[model samples]
Structures are given as C-alpha cells and as structure tokens.
Target: MLQSFMNVFTTLGDTVVVPIVIFIVALCLRVKARTALMSGLLVGVGLTGFGWIINAFTPVVTKIVRQMVSTTGINLPVVDTGWQTSALVSFHSTVGITFFIVGLILEIVLFLIGYTKVFFATNLWMNWGFMIWGTLAYFVTKNFWLSLGLSIFMMLYVLLTAEVQADRYSSYYKINNGTVGAAHNMENVVPAIILDPLWNLLHFDRVHLTPDALKEKLGILGEPTFIGGVLGIIIGILGNIRRLGTLDAWGQILGFGVKLAAVMTIFPLVAHLFGQAFKPLTDEITERYSKGDTKGLSEEENIKSKKRWFLAVDDGLGYGEPATIISGTILIPIVILLAFILPGNKTLPVVDLVSIPFMVESIIAVTHGNILKTIANAIVWFSLGLYMCSYIAPIYTHAVAQYGVALPAGAVLIASFNVMCRPLNGLIFLAWISGNPLWIGLTIIVYAAFQVFLRTRRQQIWMYLKKMSDRNIAPTSNSNMASEIKKQMIKS
Candidate 1:
C-alpha cells in the first residue's frame, strides 16, 4: 500500500507537482480560484519550457565532452553519469520514500518555527538531496535509523542555508513579488559560504564586473552569446583537432558555436517566462497582505513598507543570467583541461557539463553578477568537485553494485561531480572512510554554529540599519527591503 501510494505520488513529476502546490498555496492565501489556477498552470508551462531547454542542451554537451575524451585519450576509470543517473539511483533506493516523508515533515517544522520561510514542499523532486545523504549513510553504517537521522539533519542544514541566503539573492536580482530563490545544488552553498569571508577580506566585494562592464570593456566580444559561441568554438576545435584536419575542425567549431550561442540566447527568455508565471500569484499575495496601506509612498518606499511573505521558486530562473551562462560556458573546456592536469582527478566531468549554470548560480548571485569573480570562485569550487569526485568514486561504485545497478561493459566504476561535490556528502564520505561517527557529529555542530552566527550577524546589521532609518537617513531600496524582510522573518 505504501509503495503504491509513493509511486502514484511521484508519477505526477515536478511539472504537475509544482503547479498543484502553487495553486493550493495561492488559494490558501485568498487568491481567486481562476487566477490561482491560471498562475499555477503558467508556472508549470514556464518550468516545462525551462526543462525543454535544458534537455536540448544536455545531449549536445554530452556529445561534445565525449568527443573531447575520445580525442584526448584521457580515460579515467570511473564513468561520469552525472546527476541524472545519481538522482535515479538515489530515488530507487528502498529508503528513498522514507527520506522524502521525513524531509517534508522537517521542512514544515522549520517553516512553522520561523527557521525558514521557503517551503521546500513546492520542489518535491529535489528530495534527492535528502535521499543522497540517506542512501550514503545507510551504505556506510548498514543502519536505517542512523541514515534517517542524517538525512533529516542534512535537510535542516539546506533549509537554514536557503533561509539565510534567499533574501540577498531576491533583492540583488530585483525578483519582485516576494519570490525567494531555493537551490537544490546545496554543494554550491558550501563554497559560497567558505569563500565569502575570503572575498570580503580581499575587498573583492567592492569590484563589480557586470554585463554592462563587459560591454563597455570589450563591446560585442563581451556579449554573453558571443562569449558562449567563442568558447564553444574553441572547445570544438580542441576536441576535434587530433582527429580531424584544421578545416574540418573549424567546420565543427562553427556548427557547435552556433548551437551554443542559440542555447545561451534562448536561456534568458525561458527564464523570464518562469519568473512571469509566478508573478501573478506573488503579486496577488503581496497585494492582499499589504491591503493598499502604503499607496501614497514612493515606488521604492512601497517596497520597504510591505510586509514579508515568501513564494518559493527554483533557483534555475537566475541561472539564465548573462554572467552565469557565459561563466559556465567558459568553464566547460577548463574543466576538461583540469581533469587531465589536476592530480588524483580520476573522474572526467561529462553529463554535468550542462549543469554548470546551476552549479555556479549562487556564486554568480553572491558576486553580484560579476563574471570575473564568479569564474574565479567557480574554478576553485570545480577543483574541489574534481577532488571530491575522485575521493568518492570507489564508494559510489560499491554502493551502485550493492544496489544491483547494472554497469556498462568494462565500466567497473562511476562517479559524478553533482553527487560528490556537495560539502555535506564529502563530510559523510569522510566519516564513513574514517570509521568514526565523530566527524559527522562535528559537521552537524559546525553547521548549527554557522546558522546561529548568520542569524545573529543579520540581526546586528539590521539593527544598525534601523538606527540609520530612525535618524531619517534613507537606505538603498534593496537594503531597506532586506532589512524589512529580515525583521519579518525574525518576528514570524
């Protein structure tokens, strides 16, 4: 009975599940039924469009990477099946349903307690985050209860990170209508958090390298589509140079470049559709909550005067930003180069090549859309991903074999950047390898301490801003909204 229900529940997929949740939430918030339903369906349509774009690009990227590997003759033992395969393996686990249920309960508890405002129930498919931890934990300890606890703890960690970071992203991106960015690529969060202080210490935060800056510096060459095209052409040439003559290589390069340019060009349009789909529901909810109480205020002032409410959406909407796409495009060949040069890097990144935008989304956000800073940070993070993927490949292979997953002929091992790159997963793998539970315990402790520190630091900053506001010194609109949102989050 339980298995049947689980199957039925998951059968709808995110295309259906996300919209249904949005509709239900909108109705609960007193949005009219027709408006809510339309908003929900549009959101689904937008998401489906985004998915189609992703699907279209993935095969192209995979073919490119495979060609590069075949040309270079750099064969690593572990096959890189990427996140899709890893997610499938994770979701098929017997413990998968249990993790999803527990994660849902924990998400609700966190939201109700004001620990987080972004309800992850809306992104049900992302429960693979919890499943990864649970499946790995069970593999290590062969104990169900321990795995369950660890999965719950991992979910809590992700929620807290999202809670702390969401407002900053929304405010910076000017994503109006109370929408909060929720990322399933929690691995990116670790590097973002770790590097943030370093970035500040170096005063790199003062540097802004936005698309406008790029345009001013390099004209058409700096445009995202041009950058993507150039990079794609370079990759294609490099991939085929050993196998094809110069003219043939150039032909492949031009063809691939055009395709890549098209993908980058279409990304932002699809992303806008995604953002638009949520706008009506969010606008309605925000309006209903505000009750036209601040109609006389300035446009900026109205944003400040509004109370805090959150509408959850996937972080992918921002992945289409120019800086992110360009940076990610540039990183594809760089990752391939690093695989050969970086010591102990056994896994060659293939399928996850297209996922670079999502992987670097948070970094791009925190860097304030600075392409240079995002690329610098991504290089470091991708280096870590390579090392971590190498470290976990053996265990990953063992777990897959243990679960009776079939492998390709002569492929005894598999690993993925998407699975092993997560800081939480790295920590779990370390604990298992060391045969000491203390490492995992310490990770939890450090995570909890960091969350507390973030909360306290936010409060202190807001308190200072509030003092300025009281003195009639106006803060910037984004800062003002951030302050207001923080206060509301705390009060809730």
Candidate 2:
C-alpha cells in the first residue's frame, strides 16, 4: 500500500505536486492567495520547461553517444543502465519505504527546532537521494536500522555542507535563494576544493574559460547564445564525423547543432520562470526578517535576526548557465575515454554519460563554471569513480535480482555512474558495515566536526561569501583569507 501510494505520488511528479506544496507553504507563511497561486503556477510551468529542455537534449545527446560507442567498440563488465532505473529500484526497496515516510517526519522535526530551515517542498522527491545510499548500505549489512540511521545522517551531513555552498551557488547562477539538495553529495568536492589553488597558481584562471570570462577576450562571440551554437556545431560534427561520406550526414550534423543551440538559448529564459516561482517567498522572508526594529540590539543580535534561510532546491535551475551546459556535455566523452583508458576500470560509460552535467552540477557550483578547472576536477573524479562503480557492480546486480528486476539481455552486471561514485557516502557506508569501533567512531567525529562548523559559523560563512561577492569575485572554496577569517570567526 505504501508503494502504491508512492507510485501515485511520483507519477504526479514535481510539476503537479510542487505548485500545490508551494501554495500550501506560502499560505502557512501568510502569503497572499494571489501571490501564492502565481508562485505555485510559475514553479509548475518552470519545471515543465526544464523537463521539456532535458527531454529535447537527451535523446540527441544519447544518439550521438551511441554512435561514438559503436565506433569505439569497448565493452566492460557493468553496463550503465542510467539513473532513472536505479532511482526506481531504490524507490521500491525497503530503504526507500523507510526514508520517504520516516525522513519526512524527521525533516519536519528538524525545521521546527530550528536545526534546519530548508522548505522540504523546494527539494521535493530529492529526499529519495537518501534512499540510494541507504539501499546500498542495506545490501552490505542486511540491517534496516543501520541503513536508515546512515541515510538520515547523510541527509544531515549533506544539508550542512550544502548550506555553506548554497548561497554561492544561488548567487552564481542567479537562482532564487536555494541550495543544491541533490543525491550525488559533495564528497568529491573536497579534493577539488583542496586542489583549486593550483589552477590559480598556474595562472590558468586568467584564461577564464567560462562564458562570462570569455566575453572579456572575444566580446559578442563569447555570448552564451553564440557559444552554445558553436559548441553544438562542434559536438555535432565530432559525433557524426565518421559519417562524413554518408548521404545525409551533413544534414544530421547541422540539425543537431541547431537544436542544441536552440535549447541552450532557451534555458536562461526558462530559468527566469523558475526563479520567479520562489522570488515571492524570498521577498517575504527577507522583509519579515528585517522587521521588528533594530533599535538597541547588539550587532550580533541584529545579524542573527536578519539571517536568511536558503531552501534546498533542484539541480535544474543551475543548468541555465552556458558553462554548466558546456562542461557537463563535454564530460560525456571524457567519461567514455576514461572508461577505456583508466586502469582496472570495469564499468562501461554509457547512458549515464548523458547525465554527466547533472552529475557534475555540484562541481560547477563550487568551481563556479570555470571550464578548465571544472573539467580537470571532473576528470579526476571520473577516473576514481569508474573503479568505485565497478566495485559496487555485484551488489547492485544482486539488489536488482533480489527485487525480481531483470537485467538487460546479454548484460552480465550493472552499475550507475550517478549511484556508486559517491566517495564520502561510500566511505561512511563501508565504515558502518565494517563494524570496527574505530572506523565508526572516526566517522562520527567527521560528521560532528562538520556539523559544528556549519551550524556554528553560518553567519561568518555568509558574511565572508557576501564580502567576496561584493568584491566581484566568485567565492573561493577555501582561500587563505577565508581560512583566517574562519579561524577568527570560531574564536568570536
């Protein structure tokens, strides 16, 4: 019965459900009915636009990838059946059942206590991200409690980490006040953040490969619309290169390019609709917080009262930027090459390659869409991720079989790029299943430390990032200045 209800719930999907949820939440916040209605409708329409955009691009991109794969003729032990199938499998699992029901309850409790401030509706259905790791943990431990506990911890962990980066993401993409609450957590981002300075050290940041950066060098040619068209044409030509002598090859190439260009051009417009959906809430929240006169309050007291809550939101809103589109699309082929060349990799890069953009959205958030750094960071990630996915293949296959799901004919095993490459989640799950007191204790310490930093330093973090924004620079992940300020912030 739970699964039946879930199925119906999912079928209604974000477009239908988000608006209603948003309306209800807006009403609860005392939003005018007309404004609430507009917010909800805008959200629904915006999401529908995102769906259309994704649907339009995916098939063409997949077709291009299929050609590339056929040409390469590389085979591997695990087939990438894509994320939707994996999400479906997880949603049907015991872990999914517990997370959807229990997770919702936990979120409400956390919000009421001021432990968290995200409106659950903004990230609707994303809570299923908790189930992916939970299901994987269940595969190793056979204990539902362990799975549920870890899943809950991961949710809290991701939220805390996401809170730090959320404002930067929103500011960079011009999305309304929301943080990424997607499933592919930010584990890999730690290394990327650690290594980011090298690019600056090498003066590669001067090239500023992001579209915004390019405008400095090339003017109108660097505009996102133009860059999108050029990228589309390049991809079209490369994807169909082998068919050069074929009758309709040129037609196919130009058609794909034009379509891609159109999609890219349309994204920011759709994103505007998306932003409009939540702007009313953001405005209200900002106004409410600024009220109740700051007459005699201390600086700290005033700052605390004026603090803003960033809702957890979808990755789709981040897709509008040209850098995000370019870097993610480009990663598909990079993942393919890494699959073929990376030593000991047993997972074939296939369907999920198309999802490389969404997969790397978090990276884009941190890297601020700097193409060179983003691509370099992602290459390292995929290099390690391929092997990790390969390692998880057997358990994934068993989970599918155990659930009476059939594999594709002639497929030996399966892994999803989006599923198994979560480095931190994988570490935590391994520690739990290892049953070593030391490992479990260390994991606890890690979460506790991050929790302390995130919860305690929210204001400092916000102020620091805001200052960076005021300086007209993308927020550095962890600069020397930032580290020093944080040190002082903790003491204060």
Candidate 3:
C-alpha cells in the first residue's frame, strides 16, 4: 500500500503536488474557492515553467563541464554529478517512500507547534535531503529504524534553522506576505550560517557593490547579460582552446555567451510568474490572519499581531535573481581553476557548477545584493565545499553503491556540493570515521546553540536590514519600499 502511494506521488511530480497542497492549505485558511484554485494552478504553471527552463539549461552546462574536463585532462578519483544524481540515488533507495512519509509528518508536527511557520508541502520533492541522511545513517548503523530516526532528527534541525532566517529572507526578496522561506537545499544552510558572522566581522557586509554600480562604472559590459556572455566566452575559450583552433575557439566562446545570456534573460520572467501565482494567496493570508484593532498597539505588538505565516517555497526562487546567476557564471572558471590548483582537492566541480546560485543565495541575501561581498563569501564557502566534497566522497560512494549505482572508471568515489557541503554531513563523516558518538552529540549541541543565538539576535537582524536598505544606491521598487515602510512603522 505504501509503495503504491509512493508511486502515485512520484508520478504526479512537483507540478501536481505543489498545486494540490497549496490549494488545500488556501481552502483550510478560508480563502475563496475560486481564488484558491486559481492560485494553485498559477503556482503549478510557474513551477512547471521554471523546471522546464532548468531542464533546458542543465545539458548546456553539462556539455561545457564535460568539455572542460576533457580538455584539461584533469582526472580525479570521484565524479561530481551534482545534486540531481544524488536525488536519483536517494528516491530510488528502498526506504525512500518511508522516509518521505515520515518527513511529511514531521513537517506537519513542526508547523502545528509553531516551531516553523513555513509549510514543507510546497517543496515535497526536496525530501531528497532527508533521503541523503537516511541513506547515510543506514549505511552507518545497518539498522533501518535507527536510520529513519536520524533522518527525522535532521529534518527537524534544518526546518528550525530555516525558520530563524525566514523573516530576513522574506524581507530581502521583498515578497512581503506572499511567500515563506525554505532551506530547500539544506546543505547550504549550515555553511552559510557558520560563515555569516565572519562575513560581517570582515566588514564585507557593509561593502555595497551591485550590478547597477557595475553598469555605471563599466558601461554596457557591466550589464548582467553582457557580463554573463563575457564569462561564458572566457570559459568556452579556455575549455576549447586545448581541443580546437583559435577561430573555432572564438566561435565556441560566442556560442556559450549566447546560451548563458538566454538563461539570464529567461529567469526573471519565470520569477515574475511565480510572484503572480502567490499574490492571491498572500492577499488571503494577510486578510484572514492579521490581528484586528491595531491603532494603539506597540510596534512589537503590531508586528506580532500581523500574520506570521508564509507560503513556503523552494530555494530555486533565488536563482531568478540576476546577481545569483552572474555570480555563478563568474565562479565557473574560478571553480575549475581551483580544482586544478587547489592541492588535496580531488573532486572537480563540474556537475555542481550550475548549482553555485543555490549555494550563494543566502550569502547574497545577507550581503544585500553586494556582488563583491557575495563573491567573496562564495569563495570562502566553495573552498570549504571542495574539502567537504572530498571528505564525504568515499562514504557517499559506498551508500550509492549499495543501491546499485556504479562509479565511473578509475573513480573510486562520488560527491556533490549539494550533498556534502552541509555541516551535518561533515559531522556525520567525522563520526563515521572515528566510530564515535561524540561527534553526533557535538553537532546537536552546536545546532541547538546556533538556534538560540539566532532567536536572541532577531532585533539586531532587523536593524541590519534597515541599515543595508539605507545603504542601497539602487532605486527600490515601490513594492519593496512599501514593505520597508511597513516594517519601519511596526518597529516604531
């Protein structure tokens, strides 16, 4: 019966599952039936379109990566297939369905307890994060029940961390009440949180550099599309120069330039569609849940009285931003270069190159569109990421092999940024290697401490947001300005 249910869920995919869940939630919140249905359908359509764009781009990126690998003759012991491969290994495992069900129940429970305001239903497909943990735990303990238990604990850990950052995420995205934040890629959260304070300590957070600034300084070349095109051309020239003549290399460069520009061009349109889908739902949530009689309430009370809930959405929503894509594009050659030069680094970041946006999104948010800061933060993050990927490769290879996934020739291991970048994974790998339960205890304690620290720093975070907005030289959209004004009013 469970297997049948899992098959049905998998068949429906995110397009169906996300819409159905959103529709149900809207109805339960007393949203009008027509509005609910329309909102749900819009989300489905938007997500479907977004997924199509991603699918279209993946092969283009993969081809470039393969070319780079071949031309460079850089052989590593592990193949980096990125998160997509990991997702496949995860969902195909024997316990995939069971893990999904357990994760869903845990999300619901967390929501009911007010431990999380973001619903996980909208991103049910991202349960691959849970699957990664479960698979790893099973490999370690050889006990299914214990593995399931550990996976549940990890789910709770990530959701709680996400909840702490959701307010800032919503503010940064200027989504207002329209959408909630989710740590869809849990791997990015731990590193981001750990590194955020260091970014501030270095005063990089105060350095304001945006794409618009680049445009003013460099003219047309600074435009995101142009920059993307240039970066693509550089990468193309580098990758193909070894294999093709100068003329052909330039042609390859231009071709790559156009493809990347296309990707940059299409993303924002998809994001706008997603925003449109969420509007009705946002209106309904605000109207139904906002506190009544707010004239004399204190600022804190006023904010508290307003609805705290948001429609949880995927981290893919972050990719639509130009800065993210620009940063990711710039990082591709840098990452490849690092793979070749960075001693002790075994994994080339080919497959995960496209995922740089997801990894860098949180840093982008915290830095408030400072591309320089974002890039700086990304360098630190991915440096750690390279090491983490290397550390987890053997364990990941073993777990996947158990599911009949074969490693490539001369490849004794496998790893991806999306799977191994998490501090949770690092701790687990340490625990596994040392055969000590102390590492697990230490990880839990550190996570718990971080949450408490975040909860206490809420006011400071709001102040930081205010300061960042004030420093922003780019003109704010009316919606963003209004959101800022509303936040200010509440604080006052």
Best by TM-score: 2
TM-score of 1: 0.85
**Which residue pairs come into collision in candidate 3?**
none
Q: What's the true lDDT of residue 156 in model 1?
A: 71
lDDT of 1: 0.70
Residue 441 displacement (Å), model 3 = 2.8
Ranking by TM-score: 2, 3, 1
Stretch of 10 with least lDDT, candidate 3: 177-186
lDDT of 2: 0.73
TM accuracy, model 3: 0.87
Query: On residues 178-259, what C-alpha lDDT tens digit does candidate 2 reach at each position?
Result: 6677767455556556666676677655555777667756898877767767776776677777888886877777787787
- Give me the runs in candidate 2 sitting further than 4 Å from their true place: 290-306, 463-492
Model 3 lDDT per residue over 1-492, tens place: 767777787788879988898898788878999999998898888888889988888877778777887887778776787786677777776556688887887787777676666677667777777777677767766777767766666676777656545555666665654333333344454455565566667765555467766776689878777877777787777778775667766676788889888888788788777777777777666667764344355534433542465567766677867877887777777777877887898877767778777777765665567677667756776777778788778878888888777776667788776667555556654554344568667766776786676556654644554454345445546657899999999999
Model 3 bad stretches (over 4 Å): 178-207, 216-219, 243-247, 292-307, 428-437, 453-492
**Candidate 1 residue runs with Cα over 4 Å from true position:** 177-184, 196-208, 244-248, 289-309, 402-404, 432-437, 459-492
TM-score of each: 0.85, 0.88, 0.87
In candidate 3 the C-alpha lDDT for residue 183 amounts to: 35
